[model samples]
Target: MVFEYILKKNGLDPSTDLTIDQSISFGLTAAAFTSSDADYTIEFEPFATTLELEGNGSVVASLGTESGYVPYTAYSARKSYIKQHPEVIQSFTNAIQRGLDYVNSHSSEEIAKTISPQFKETPLDKLTQIVERYKAQDTWKEDTVFEESSFELLERILEEAGQLKETVPYKELVTTEFSTKAVK
Candidate 1:
């Protein structure tokens, strides 16, 4: 859902050097492999992280200030630990602030009517509560931009792992010109 659209929409060159790491089973852990010459990666969920970031070791990328991924459903103990420790858990709050602001500014009926078609499985009333919770507390950061600094961290991670064969030029990997258009 994320990688496919974001990659193609940005005109990333594929085939010659493009590769995705869906191996580790979790997007977070799988992201470690991106340190290689691999063009792109997508490991949505390890189905479980115990099997992902812990065993066989995982290189944690130092994003500096480029932002990071936070699970929207981080009320779980494991998530709480990651959030409380370090990395971009603050990004989680930032994204939630934006989403909550959106939900609060909109009316309940308006929200329901607007999203009903988008989520056919979720009943209107259930969605209403979901929106209410989202308005009440933010748990997702779907709007964060992919910063170059973050990509640089990925490069260093791969290099340290001895996975990088050459270098991935910035222009070849990202295009903020278009992404910024969506930024608020």
Candidate 2:
């Protein structure tokens, strides 16, 4: 949906202008692109960086940058769960905000080193490069609070992709209670 939204925003019709192969699973996009199966693929780091390092493809554009704020990463809980575990949710939100604060305060190199254990196959230099790219794009929000405008942007993107039948009011779908309190 994000890819299609970026395409349409740029004045191209995704349905008619070009072929977007949705058959490739998210995990294999980099492999498919590297294998020359597709001329271009939208990928998240460090796949994009890996492809560029391998000389398979170039990072042409960023969907995140192009699509604007869409609240792509967020936490969700069932209403019942939230009602029962407000304290748990608050703790989780605080932890998330602390992570955000760490990333915002630290350099890309520091972040890459800290997270390198999760991606043992990916070298520190490459991971740093990926983090650098993301930092340059302001990929992380200042806080975990999912803004109303960002939620609306997400809804608009969903609606444009024909996935959403109607827009949900921000208040009905999102609560800033935990995230707002976390930042404070």
What's model 2's lDDT at 34? 75
Model 2 compared with the native: what TM-score?
0.95
Name the top TM-score candidate.
2
Q: Candidates' TM-scores?
A: 0.31, 0.95
How far does residue 67 in candidate 2 sit from its true spot (Å)?
Answer: 0.6
Which residue pairs clash within candidate 2? none
Off by over 4 Å in 2: none
The sequence of per-residue lDDT tens digits that candidate 1 reaches over residues 2-114 is: 33323343575433336654555453554464345643333322212222334533323212112233222322225456547534544454555566456557876677778
Q: Model 1: what TM-score?
A: 0.31
Q: Please give the range of 10 consecutive residues that has the lowest summed lDDT in model 2.
A: 32-41
